[model samples]
Structure formats: C-alpha cells, structure tokens
Target: MHRAKLASFAFPDRPAGDAMSVIAPQAAVPRPVSRVLVVSGDAALTEQIVRGLNATAQRLDNPHGLVALAVAQVDQALARVGSDGELQVVLIDDGAADLAGSGPAADLAVQLAALRPELSLYRLLPADAGGSSGRRAFDGVAGEAIAGWFDRGEVDPVGWFRILAAEVAEKAATPFYDRLKAYVALAKDSWHTPGHAGGDAYLGSPWVADFHDFVGEELLRADLSVSVPMLDSLLHPGGVIAQAQQLAARAFGARRTYFVTNGSSTSNKVICQTLLAPGDTLLLDRNCHKSVHHAVILSGARPVYLDSSVQPHLGLFGPVPQVRLLQAIEAHPQARALILTSCTYDGLRYDLAPIVAAAHARGIKVVVDEAWYAHARFHPELRPTALECGADYVTQSTHKVLSAFSQAAMIHVNDPDFDAHLFRENFNMHASTSPQYALIASLDVARRQAVMEGWRLLDRSLRFAAELREQIDATGAFRVLTLDELLADEVRGDGIRLDPTKLTIDIGASGWNADELARVLLERHNIQIEKATHRTLTLLVTMGTTRSKVSRLMDAMQRLAREARSRAPASRPVPRRLPELPHFNRLACLPRDAFYEAGERLPLLDDSGQPNAALIDRVCCDQIVPYPPGIPVLVPGQVIDVAALTYLVRLLRTQQATDLHGLADVDGERQLRVLRREEAAPGLAPAV
Candidate 1:
C-alpha cells in the first residue's frame, strides 16, 4: 500500500528494538509467495477482492500480509513486483483490461510482457462472488488461442491464480531430472562409490555374479553417488532436485518442498529440529510417532503432551478431542509448535484444518505427520489433507502409498516463518552422504505420477476399499470401520472427512484378536496388512491396489472370520487404553536432558506402587518404545510413572517384530535404563 514499503516488503519489516528473532533471513528467490498482492482499480468489486485476500492472509497468518497498492497508472503496479518477485499473483480490477494496448491495464500488461516475457496471463469472468480459491460455476467456457498460448474460460479466479503461479514456477525452474536422465543414458565409465562399480566389474564368484546378472546392471548404475555432477546434489539442490521439489510444492499445495530419502521419520525430525530450540515448549499429540519424540530430544524442546481419546469400539486412539486440544493450546500460549498425527495407523484421523488456524493464531508452528496419507490429495473425498488443511509443515512417506521405493519420502513446507537453511542443515546431518540415486529418481517419478494419474488411481482405490468394506460387513464376522466412525465428532462440528482408501477392520467381538487374524492371513493365505492393533487390522488401499487383489483379500478375511467363529471359542481381547498418567509422568523433565544424561540399567519392577518415589521421579535416560507403531512410551529424561510403565509392559507382551528399539527388556527379567540423578540437579516443580 505504501511506496516506502515496496523495497522492504520482500523482506519482513524489522521491528525496532526487537533484539533477535528465531528466523534467519533467507534467499526469497527459492521460496514461493504465500500471500497475494492486490492492485486496486476503479471497479466496484475491487474492494471485495482486496478484503478476500487480506482476510485469507490474516487467517493463515501468511508471512506476507496484504498490500493494497493504489496505482492509478501501470508503472506503479509494475514497481510493486518488478524489483522484488515477492509479490504473489497480482489481481487487477474487473473489466480493467484494454485489449487496444492503450489503457492502464494494457499498459501494465505490456510492461509485464516486456519484463517477465513468457508469463501466462489468463482472463476469467466470474458468474458470482465465490469462496477462496475462487471456485465458481462456469456459464460459458471457451478457449481463444493467444499466439497459440492463451485460452479464455470462466472458472474460479483463485484456482486459476494457483495454477498460473505453479506453471510459472515450473517453467522458470531448471530441468535437473532431464539432465540426470541424459547423463544416465551416456553409460559412462565405472567410477564412484559401491565397490561393485555399476555391476560391470566381476566379483570373481559365479554365484554372486549370477545374482548381479539377475538383478540387472542398471540397479547399480542408477545407485550412483552425489559425485555425479550431471545429477545435482540433493543437499544443495539448485538444479533438478530443486525443480522436483518445486513441482512437489505445487502438487502438494506447499510454499516449499524438501525431499527426504530416509523416510517420513527423518522428515519429521527435520521439522522439529529446525523450528524448536532448547527449553521451548511444543504441543504434541500423545499418539504421534516416536520420531517426533526423537526430534524433541534432538531439539531439546519441552513437550506438552495432549491426551488421546480411546475408541471403545475399535480399541484404538482417536484424535485428541478438539476441546481438550484447544485447552492445551490455551494453557501453553508460548509453545513454539503444535505437532499432530493427521491419520493414525488404522486410518483414524481428525480434520486439523481448524486446529491449524487456531494454532497459527497463537503464533505456534503447525506440523502434521501424514506419513500414511501420501495419496490423500488425489481425490475429493480424501480432501483437506494436512497440506490442504494449511499446516506449516507436513511429512509423507511416499513409498507407503505411492509407487516410490521404500524409504523415499517428502516434506512439504507452507509456513512463512520456515527457516530453509536450518532445515537443510538438519536434513544434511541425517541424510547419507552417499545417497541412493534410484530412490531419488523414484521420488521424482512418483511425484509426476501422482500429479498426472493420481485422480484415476485414487478413485479406483476408493471403489475397491468401499466394495471390500461392504462385502466384509455382509459376512457378519467383521464390521468395517467407516469414515463416519472417525468423523462422528468432526462431522457434527466441521466438515472434515476421512481417507476412503484406508480400511480399518474390527473383530473385537469375535474370538480372534488383530494379531491372530493377521497371522492367519499371512500364514494360511498370502495376504499381509499394514498394521494390527489389539482388536483391529489396518489395510492401506493404495494406488497400486487392484480389484482382483481386493476380492482375494475380502474372500480371505471372510473365510478367516467364519473359521475363527466356528473353531475358536468367542473370547474378546480387552481394547488397548492409554494408561492413566502419574504426577511425575505429567511433569516430564526435558527429553533432551534425559537423552544426554548418564544412565544405568536396573531391574524393572512390575508393581507400579512398589517402585520408590526416587526411582519414579528420576529422569529416564533410555527410550522405551513399543513395536507396531513404535511410538515412544517413555523417552530419555522423561519421568517414568505407573501409567507409562504399565503401557510399556503390556506392549512388551504383545509387541511383535520390526525391531523393538530403545527398550531394555531382556528374557523374563525386565530392565530399564534410567538417569542416575545427582544430588546437585536443579529443582523440579516441587513434585506438584
């Protein structure tokens, strides 16, 4: 709005005497515009548009706020975005265009054309006022070629702007992937890491060589190192990787996207490690993956754990009740971040859109671990993904749902306050120096596939899952978990829906527990599920899941359910419940402190009341994680209490394979590694 602000609008206005900020100045060139800039004109509807943009900016706490530049002339509008590319799409007043190339609008168009050159400028006529993203009913849609480039149509102005912005970004970015492909095709000399050297050099063993022959030479060739200059480095990707990330950012509706090869775990850690500092408070979902706790330990942030509501019917953790979550937010006003588990392992999730806004309003960063929801945005029923919900940070395990190789993942960043350098530093710290090139390429291909064929693939997946659910319910032995079950509370309050691609099966009333049913499927039949809880088995219906496979899975489940009912006595396993917390557990010592403290292994006591107050109050110096979901029950330095201890003990009894990391349970003698409290440690909150 003010001429004095134009030059500095690209950078945030520095507050006078505001000593320091957590955010470091970044090169805004690599970042997308999170806010919109509206240039005013004489049209009566200009004010409404301006209001809409400003309201959105305020709502999202967009790092870039609204700037109403009142420019009577075209030069002023050009001046707003010319020197600084910080301005998002500029919306000119309605009917303000003069095709004659003489009026203010035409003058502005000429300047944009002369400067930016190839920017796609589309004109859309709206039938009526619409919502944000400007989605509206099209009356007459037609295309008029502009130098065989421009097309005319009537649609949502907001949607058009987003599409236009993405196209412009993609066009401007260098094609790193194309160059890498070209380099791969060259089939150059054997040079880099991995002693095999592209599977060309024989190992001098017939069996090993035969294995290599079977695996093919391309596997090793594509597993090239970062030394290959043609395929740019991921850590400092200014080339193809950056372009891929930008493409991902747009595809995922993010301001920025960072590719993570280690999986969503590393992505989760990166978000926390970058945003939080030592002693800072972060609101955490009690049911979050253990990696979030690992990030907390690494960052030295204090966690204000939110309680999870246990689903009695399914024996699973539902979302932290919104009322309870809001109360936690109100309690910890100074929290640096709010981390939520968007969808649980069994497909239970909350509509975090409203929560993100609420958390953002309190100046808290929002991070959602949507690790199981990489394909959520492909369909409308699975709408309002964490990215669409406006979370500051969202992590997805692409391989879990998409066709990418295992360990290929991505982090979508949409926050204005995100520190890219800080994130990269952590990412580099965790990422391998000799990265997997094939996985990286797969991520690129996966992103493209999702962008191109996602809708059709997801639609098919939904049909498959829905049909199986209906068929399974008809068998009478299993009752399928519905979106209605998870959204009962949310639907009544907000319109947030569930991902139809994930199926949660309930056999709580049957003779078989989840593990028993899962075992039968894996051993008797050749079907495996994503995860299993006490009373439910979770199946991930992905893009690759076919109708034939769905039919087989349904048939197997029905037969197994009928057999269990007839052959086995009806005995229902108790639904797992979060243990009631103790005073010491509620007031956790910092996880970072506990993680670093000296610890000694001591025999674990089964009786909760038998452990001395000294033992219970002492900081835990070991991670006590349960298998399956592998979430931490007690992280290092946190006070160990009856509830957490009890939960862990139960978990140890029921937990199966996949590495029970950080636990000290050996044979029948349970042991715990706890912090050896010194006499000189700082005082806690006087034991409440």
Candidate 2:
C-alpha cells in the first residue's frame, strides 16, 4: 500500500502516538515502489527498451510500469529518484554513456542511491558492446542478455514488479480502448463504407486497443460514413453542416460564409479558382501569405508585386506601403483585385481603408488573408477587420484565436461580386469527404463565444498587454513597440501602428538576439514566448491570459534583463536583403498543370534552380510556417529563391531547428510534386 505521508521514510522510529501516524494510517503499511527511471543515451534505444519491458510483462500477465527519460541532467535524475514514493531502479544505457561525456553511469548510480537508500541501479549494454556497430535484434541476442540480467540480482524484484505494474495501469486507464471494444460488439448494418462491412467474414480487422487513445474515442465513435445521419449529404449538401456555416457567417458579420475543414491555405485556392481566370492581374503584397501565391497559380493570374519596407531595426517584415499599392495599380491598370494581411503575426495593423478604396474605385475585388487577425472583428479598438473595412472576400481562421480546432475556418463573403454557391462547392471539394461533426460543433461554439464575449475579453487582453509593456520598459532592458507614439515619428514611418493586444518587446537594449532570449526563458524558467528573431520577441495575449501569469512573466523578464546587462553589448549584424526576383515565366508552373502531373521530393539544396511548386513547411511537425509573422518563404507553385533558401538554412541551424531541412510536405510523408517538363509545353495549359 502507498503511504499518505512521505515523512515515514525520514522518521521510521517515530512514536506510535505521533501526529504523523495519526494523520497517515497507510504509512504503517510497507510502501509499494512507485517511481522508476529507465535511461538511455540513444533516444530510439530508450524507446525500444521501454517497449520491450511492456511486451515482456504482457507475455507473463504482469503490469508494465516504469517512467523513462532519455539522457537527463544530474539534478533531474536525482529529483525523480528522491521523491516520497521514490524510484526503485535506474536503467543505464551503456551505449549512451559512451557517446555522452564519460562517468555518468557510475556517477548517476552513486547519486541515486544517496538520494534514496532503497533504490537500486540496473546497467543495460548491447550484447555486442565492443563490436558489430552495437546494433543487435532485441528479440535475438539482446533479449537473452536482458533475460540473464533479470536472473541476476541486478534486475531484481523491484524492476520486475515495476514493469508488471506499468502494463496493468495502461490496460486499466485507457477509455479509448474500452470504447473500441464496445463498438465491436454492436450489431452491424449495411450502413457504412469503410467498404468492408465492419470487417465481415473475409476480412476481420485485428483488434488494436490504441486507436481511440490516439485521437479520443468519441471522435472515432462519431466518425460515421457519409450515409450516416450525422453528415447532411455530401452528394447534395443541405443539413446540420450547412446550418453551421450559416451560423459562422451571421456571427462574423458577413452576408455569406463557407466552412473549410482543409484550412485557410486551401480556402485561398478556392477563392482564386472561383473568381480569377487567365490574363487577369492581382495587386499583391510583397509580404503576402503563401496561400495567396498558390491562388495566383490556380487562377492563372499575373501578380503585380507591391514592395513592403523591411524594418531594419527589428529585422522584421511589415505591411505593404500605400505608395506601392497605388504605384502597382497605376502600373497595371487591368488589375482585378487586391490582397493583404491586416494584423501581422507580430500584431502590426495596416491602414487598409485608403488602399481598399483605391481598389474599389477601379471596380476591383479584394481578398484579405486575415488568418492571424481572426479576433479583429470583436473589438472596435482593434483595426477594422477586412469585412469591416469593406473587402470583397475576407478569409479568416476562426480556429486561430477563437479556439476552434485547427483546420476549422470561415471564408466570409462581404461583396456582391462573390458567388456564395461557387465558394461552397469549392470548400467541400477541398475539405474532407468524411467531415467530423465535432469539428462543425467546435466552429459553432467558437462563433457563439466570440460574438458573446470577444469584445470584453479582447479589452481585458489589451490592458494586460499594456501592463506587460510598461513593466518591461521600466527595467530599461526592453521597450514595447507601440503605434500610437512611434507611428507619428520619422524613424518608425515605415512601421504600421500595432494592435494594443500585441505585446511585441524590442530587446535591442539587452544586446541579445530574440532567438537567444527565447531559449533562455524556456530553459531557465519554463516560460514560452512566440517566435523570436534578430530584434523582437512577440507575446500574444488572449482571453485565457490572467494577471497572475503576466506578473510571473514580468518577474522572469526582470531577472533575465539583470543578467543580460552585465554582458558586453552584442555586435549588431548588417541587415540582409531578398535575392534577385526569379524570372516568373521560367520559374513558375501553372497550378492547373501541376495539379495533373506527378513529381518527386528533393532536398532543399538540390531544389535550387529546380521549380518548387508547393508551400514551404515551417513549424515543428506542424504546417511549415516560419513562426513570428509566419509568411512562407517558398510558396506553392513558385520557384524557390536563393535569398529565401539562405534564410531557411540559417533557421535550420539554430536551437529552434526541429526538422533537418524545410523540404517535405506538411501533413505526412508525401513529397512536394511539381509539374514535369513534358506537361509544361505550350498550349498544353494556357497561362495569364
């Protein structure tokens, strides 16, 4: 039995009448070992060892129980081993010990034993420790070595019991596994098309207990085929899904809205496919989202690029300038539409009304990728959202700020020129054929929440952001970028006034790059901020933020500022520039043609000169978006730029590097496919 009090370990000879015994009666019972640590230098090896322990317990009808860490620090190992229900054993990975600095094996064992007198240590080395690349089959020779260790006192009774307990707990606590088992027992009808009739006589699916655990059992239970009543009807839509779309439109102050489960990237494609055709020109922002470029490819539109002023001080990208917008429109009189980002990820808000008016005067349509600024609609203090500013097509990520699940977004139609029916048709085509009812429900709930409390919540967020800025400024190590004071000045003329809710801290005074500061904060204090670049660290405040959390962050910032002030001022690096623009005729392939062709994946280095026809991947195991102001460097259906490639190469080298190269596709292992040379012949596919 586990003790209610851990004091028993320290005071084993306490009097029977003591208050400790009175409060924790269970302390009298001998404690069953609870905590454990399985260590390995190789991440893959550690995982395999843990898996083998679970598999062994399964064969013997034992519970597999143990907590594992891959190459942890000395303090972390000691802390875990020294707990009330302290760890019983440490599994040392011999291979990892050799790779890492030596002495960890013997040193860790001594430290763990000192921390917990009852704890034991287990040493695990590959069978061929000195030969054969140290890679042996776990079931073959490695398993035998492990079995021999089990026989010796080294593995011991505690190790065996801990492994057994882990398996038992895993089996008992999983709700998803239970739900899957229950579903199997339900009677089958000819109601779904997994197409196998729930694995009938010819094909029985092997029972996998972990499916529900992967994505929640309720979602699996609700994953009914289109024939099920939950989906209105994919062949001819009209039902609950359609109603959800209507609700989104109403809440966001739009005449019409389309639900896109595919994400804003695909929504962008649909907007272009429905509106533009070959020979048309689009007034494009230099700092445009990747999706907009993809739209240009699909729509066969020629883009008139409007250059944006790069903020040299911040080493950041901002909104397109008004002069450039006018210049582009004047230069390309045949332009049919305009597109831009309103509130940049760094929270910069562009003065778009004047630009919107200029485009509308020419009877041109406007589409704004307000993806990051989805919360702009609820607060009047925030810049007028695309819809409020009279943009023809406003694409927003309701899921982004409003708390809907990812891939749940809305395409609002605010202009008479936009065809609602056409937008819906493309939305359904690009989105999932098997749409989730829960996703629909989440969109509905987010919309309702935003309508009811968005303004009040945003107002609170604004105050919190302001307070944080003030505190950071008081320390003299950083200053918050505010549009109110800065926009009126000459030096900040190129910068857009920012939303009050955006807490963008300029760390120029601290003499450290934003990247270094970000790492320090997370490693030392366990606090995470948004992406940090050369000059700025951005923090986004939402309705979920509280004053206490802000205060803690403030304290941490002050401590970091103190540390940084003592260091020599960092040398400022000269600003970088974009490469010579690629020759559009030779570099880009029409999306319609690329869509019908097949290609292969190549490394980012090998991809130079070769046409890149897909969006650049950015995040860690997420859609590839370069975080602070996540505009893609390489857009889909466009050739990769040397300058953009250089930017990505530098990003990959930093501690921020998660993936090796920024080449592969976002969702899965599928490679980016561009049109082959044979498919790009004249008249085979016409271009703008």
TM-score of each: 0.72, 0.58
Candidate 1: which pairs clash? Answer: 134-156, 176-240, 594-637, 620-637
Task: Give each model's whole-structure lDDT.
Answer: 0.65, 0.58
Give a tens-digit lDDT track for model 1, residues 241-279.
887888777667788988888999999888888888888
Please give, for residues 374-422, the per-residue lDDT of candidate 2 as tens digits. Answer: 8876665564677767888888877777777788777888888766677
By lDDT, the best candidate is 1
Residue 600 error for model 1, in Å?
Answer: 2.1
List the candidate 2 regions with Cα displacement exceeding 4 Å.
1-220, 223-225, 230-237, 484-496, 566-688
Clashes of each: 4, 15
> What is residue 265's positional error in candidate 1, in angstroms?
0.9
Query: Candidate 1: which stretches are off by over 4 Å?
Result: 1-177, 202-204, 484-496, 568-584, 606-614, 650-661, 666-668, 683-688
Candidate 1, overall lDDT?
0.65
